[model samples]
Target chain A: MTIPNEISGSINNIRPMSQSANRLMNIVADPEYDCQDIIDVVAMDAVLTAKLLRMVNSVAFGLRVPIDTVARAVPYLGERMIVGVSLGLCASHLYNKPLTGYESEEGALWTHCLRAAIAAREIARYANDKTILDVTYTGGVMHDIGKSVISIYLEGSPRKIVQGADSGKFTDYIEGERQILGTDHCEVGAAVAAHWRLPASLTAVVRHHHEPGNSPQEHRALAYAVHLGEFVAMMGGTGTGADTLMYRIDENYKDYISISAKELELVVFNTGQEYEKIVSAMFDGQETAF
Target chain B: MKTILLGVGDLGVTNKPGEELQAQSLGAGVAVIVADSRTGCIGMDHIALPDSTVSLRRAEEKPGYFADTGIAALLEAMKVFGSNISEGGMIVKLVGGANVMDPNSTFNIGRRNVQAVKEVLWKYGLGPVAEDVGGRVNRTVTVESITGKIRISAPGREAWEL
Candidate 1:
C-alpha cells in the first residue's frame, strides 16, 4: 500500500519569507532593537523601504509630514509597527491564498487575519508579560495557516464541514476536519511552521490556539490571546467564512487577560473600524464576492 | 430591480417591483428584522449587538443598534412602502440571531437578540410567520420585493426560500 502525504506536501510548497524580510521580522520583534537597526534592515530592500515610506505618509497613518526615508518611518511608526507592515507585504500571498473550503469569498481570510492581528495586539497589552507583543501579533496573523494548507483536501466536502460548523451544538472544527481528512489543519499548520523554521513558540501558538486549554504552559498565553483574537474578528464580522461560529471561545481567557465585557465590546468596535481602515489602505476596499 | 445592502445598525425599505434587499454575514449578536408588504415592498434592518444585561432605558439611546430599537425602526420604515401595521397584513420574517458563538462563553448575545426581537414583536402585536434563527452559520438573507420571497443561505450550502 502506498501512503499519500498531504500536510508535508503543503508545507513544502509554501515559500518562506525572504532572508532580509526574516531579519527585519526578528529585529522588529525584539524590543532591544533601535531605530538604526530597523533602518539598517529595511534599507536592504529598496521595494520595502519605498513602500514603508509611502505607507507612513499615507492618511491612514495620520502623518501630516511625509516620511522621505526609512529612518524617519522607523522612528515615526516604531519598529513593531514596521514589522507588522512588513509581514503583510512579504507574506501577502499567504494571507491572500484562496481557501475555497474554509472561506466564503476571496480575501476573507486576509481580512480576518488583519483584524485578528490587531485584536491580538490589544489583548496582549493586558497580559502580565509585555514581551509577547510581537509574537502574539505574528501568531494571530498566522493562526489559520493550516486552513489554507488543508483547504484543497476538503474542497469536495465543504457541505459537510459547513454542516458541522453550523450544527450549533458547540462542535469542534478540528474534529470535523479530522473526520474528513486523516489529519487536521492545526497539526498541518504546526508542521508547516516547523518546515518554515519559525520559532517553536510561534508553532505552539498556531497549534494550540483552537484548544488553548491543552497548550503547554509556556505557550498558553499567546495561544489564549490568539484564540480570543479570532473571536473578536468573527464577532466583528470582517472575515466572514463558513466556520464563522464553528470555533469555541475559552471562558478562562478573561482570567488570563482580565478584560471586562464593556471593554471587550469597545475593543471589538475599535478593531472593526481599524480593520476597515487597513483594508481600505491595503486592498483599496476590494472585497471578494460573498 | 434595486438592491440595498444593510450594514449592522442599518435599515431600509423599498416598494419598487423586482427590487431586492439583502443583509449578509450576520453574527450571533446581530439580527435581521424583516417586514414584507406581501406584494411589492420589503423592509429590513441589520441590528447589531443588544445586551439584555443592560436595561432598555440605557439601550434605547441608540435604538437602531439593538434589537428593541432596531425592530421598531424597521417596522416604522415599512410604512413608507405602504405597510399597514395595525391592519396586520404585514408578513414579518426573522432571518438571523444564530448562536454562532461558543456555548461556554459568559454571554450568548445571539439568543438575547432573538429574545428581544420576539418580545418587541409581541408588544407590537406582530409575530414572524417564518424564522430561521439559532445556529452557528453566518446567514445571508435576500428578499425579493415583487413576489415577497426571502431566501437565506450560508457558505457551501444550498440557498432555500424562507
Candidate 2:
C-alpha cells in the first residue's frame, strides 16, 4: 500500500540511519563478510564503539572479563546484534517518544521495542533457528518503527479504534488503523525501513510482522519470530499502549517456528529478565527511569 | 505520601500511612492487591505467568513473576507489615489478567494466570473480595495502604473503585 503523501514526506524528513549503522548493515548482509569488517566499521565510529563495549560488559551479558575493545565486543555481540544495537542507538530519539495517539507515555515504545528485541532473540535461540537468531532481534527492534511516525496522526482516535476492534466492527487494530487512517503502522514502518536503506530481511519483518504468513517465504521465519516476540513483550506487560496485543496472531507461526509449550513459557520468562537488565544498563546514565 | 511503582514480575508492600502501591499497564499479566483492615497494611503482586516451573531458578530469583509463587510471596510480604492471614482479617482484590492477544488463541495466558492465582488463593482459603479481571482491556491497579481501597483504571475509561 502506498503511504499517504503527507506521511511519506515525514518519513523522508526522519533522520537518516547513521553511516556506521548503514555500513554495519551492509557487511552483515554479505554472506562472506568477515569479523574484521564488522570490527573496522564499529571502531571507525567512536560513539558506536563505546555503546558496543558498554553493552557487552553490561550486567545483562555478565561477562566476568570486561570487553574493552570494539574488536572483541563485535564478535561477542555478533554481527546482527551489533547491527541491531547500532541502528537502535542511532534512532533512539524516534523510539523515545510519548506516542500520544496511543495514549502511551514517553519511553513506552522504546521499552516495548527493546523488550520485543530480547524476546525475539530468546525465541529464535529456543527454537534452534541459529540462522535467524540475532537477525530476529534486529527485526523486533525495528518492527514498530512505523508507530513513531504514525502516532501523531492517530491522536484522539485510539479509543474509537480499540472499541471498534473489541466490538468486532474491525478485524483487529491493523484493520482499525487502515479503515480510520488510510494506512497502518506496518505499511508505514516498511516505508521507513526502505527510507533508512535497511536490509531486505529487516524490512520484511517490519512490513509483515503483524501477519507473518503474508511475508515472503524466505523471511517468514524471522517475521514469525518477531511477531511472537512482540506478543511475549505485551504478555509481560511491556506493551506501548492501548494497541498492545490488539493485533491478531497468525497461527501459521507454528509452521515457521517450532517451539513447544514449555519452551514458549521459558521464552516469556527469560525475555522479561533480560529486558529489565538491558533497559537498566542502557539507561544507566540517562534521565529515564525504567 | 509515597507511591511505589510495581513492575512486571515484582511486588511491593507497605505499612506506612497514606502510601500507595501501584502496578501500571498490565496486559495479560495479573496484579493482586491485599489490604489488611486491622493493620492497615497494603501490598500488591504483579504476576507475569501462570507457573513457576517454567524456570524454577528464575522464579527463585523473582518469584513475583509467576502466579503460584507471586501469591505466596505477596502474602509473605504483607505479613512483614503485620497483616493477618486469617479470614476476614485481610481483604483481597484482583485486577488485570486480560487476554489482550487474539481471543481465539489457545494459549490464553491471562485466563491461565487468573486460574492459577485462584487455585493458589483457594489453597490458602482466601478469595478475592472484589475483582476486575478477564477482558481484552489493559488495566492499571493501585491500592491505598491506609484505606484499603483498590482503584482500577483503563485507557479511555474513568477510574473505578474495585
Candidate 3:
C-alpha cells in the first residue's frame, strides 16, 4: 500500500534520534566495537554522559559504590543498557506521550517499551549462540515507535478497531489497522526506523517483532527474540493499551530460541524486577520529564 | 475515600466504607475481586501465573503471584475484615486473562491463569458471580467497598459493572 500523505506527514513529525545516540547505535551494531568506542562516543555528549552516570548510580543497576566515570559505567551497563538508555532519551517525546488513540494513559507506551527491552535481553540469554544482546534490546525499545505516529488517527474509535480486528476474519490487530487506516504500525515503525537511519537489524525487529516468521532469514532470530520478549512483557501485564496482547506470537520462535517453560517463568520474573527498577531510575526524581 | 492500588502479585482487603481497591493493566494476569454483600467489605488479588510451582521461592515471597497462593492469600486477608466465604455473603468477580493472538501456543498464560483461578475457586466451592475475563484486551478492575460494586474498564470499552 502507498503511504498516505497525512501519515507521511506524521512520520516526518517524529524527532530524529540524537547524534550521539545514533553514533552509539551504529558502533553497537558492528560486532567488532569495543567498550572504549562506546565510552568515547558517550563522553563527547555531555548531557548523555550525565544521564548515563545518573542511571548507573540509580538503584536500578545496584552498584554498591557510586562510580562517577563513563569508562566504568560503560562496561557495567554493557552494550544493551547504554543503547537502551540512549534510545530512550532520544525518543522521550514519542515514548512519553499518552496514546489516547489506543486509550492508554500517559507513560503507558514508555513502560511497555522498557519492559519489552528487559524481556528481549532476558530472552536472548537462551539463544543458541552469542546473540547481540544490545541489538535485541534496541529492537525492543524501538519496536513500537510507529504507534506514536498512528495513535492520533485511532482516537475515539477503539471499539470499532477491536471489533473489526477480533470479530472479523482478520489475522490480528495489525491487519485491522491496515484495513481501517490504510497503514499499520509495523509499516509505519519501519518507516520511522528508516527515517531515523536505525540499523537494519533493529529496523527488522521493528517491522517483524509481531510476525518474526516473515522477517528476512538473516535477522529472523533477533526478531524472534524480540517477538517473545514483547509477549513476555504483555504476559507480565505491561502492555500499551487497548491492543495489548492483540498481536499473534509467531510460534516459530521455538526454532530460534530454546527457552523451557521454567525458563519462561524466570524471564517474566526477572523482567518484572528489572522493569520496576528502570522505571524508578528513569522517573524517580524527574516527574515532569515524561 | 482512600483508594488502594494493587500491582502485579499483590492483594488487599478493606472493610472501611467508601474505600476502593483497584488493579490496572492486567494483561495475562487475573484479578479476583471479592465483596461481602451484607458487610460491604472488599478483597482483591492480582495474580500473574497459574501455578506457584513456577518458582516456589518467589511465590513464597509474593503469594499473590500465582492463582493458587493468591486466591488463598486473598481469602485469608478477607477474614480479617470480618468476611467469610462459608457465610454465603461473599460475591466474587474475575477479570483479565487476555491472550496474545495465538490460542495454540503454550505461552497462552492468560488462558491458563483464568483456568487456574477458577480451579482454585472451585476448591472452595466458590466461583465468580460475575466476570469480565478472556480476550485480547488489558483491563483495569475497581471495586467500591461501600457499594459492593465492581467496575471493569478497558482501553476502548466503556466502564461496566460486573
TM-score of each: 0.83, 0.91, 0.92
Q: Per-residue lDDT tens digits of candidate 2, residues A21-64?
A: 78877676554668788788889999988887877787767788
Residue-wise lDDT of candidate 3 within A1-290, one digit each (tens)? 66699999988887788998899888877766687888888888888889888877877677899988888887667767777878777788898888888888888887888899899989998877555566778788889989988999988766777777767667677887787789888889999999999889989989888889989988888898889998899878788787877777777677888877667767887888778777777775777333
* Interface RMSD of the candidates, in order: 2.9, 2.6, 2.0
Chain B TM, per prediction: 0.84, 0.93, 0.94
| DockQ values per model | 0.39, 0.49, 0.59
Q: Please give the range of 10 consecutive residues that has the lowest summed lDDT in model 2 chain A.
A: A281-290
User: Candidate 1, A177: how far from true, in Å?
Assistant: 1.8
lDDT of 1 by residue, B1-162 (tens): 677887666777887876788887776645454554454567777766654234365345545566767777777777766676776667778877766454444335567677777788889887888789876667888787767778788776788888
Candidate 2: where are CA atoms >4 Å away? A30-34, A54-67, A74-81, A126-130, A288-290, B100-106
Sort the predicted structures by DockQ, highest score first.
Answer: 3, 2, 1
Evaluate model 1 with DockQ and give the value. 0.39
Off by over 4 Å in 3: A59-64, A74-78, A288-290, B86-88, B101-104
DockQ, structure candidate 2: 0.49
Model 3 residue A211 distance off true place after TM-score fit, in angstroms: 2.3
Task: Write down the worst ten-residue block by lDDT for model 3 chain B.
Answer: B99-108
The per-model lDDT (C-alpha) reads 0.70, 0.82, 0.83
* Candidate 1 lDDT tens digits, A14-110: 8987776677656644646565876787888887887777666766677677779887776666665566667667776766677777655666776
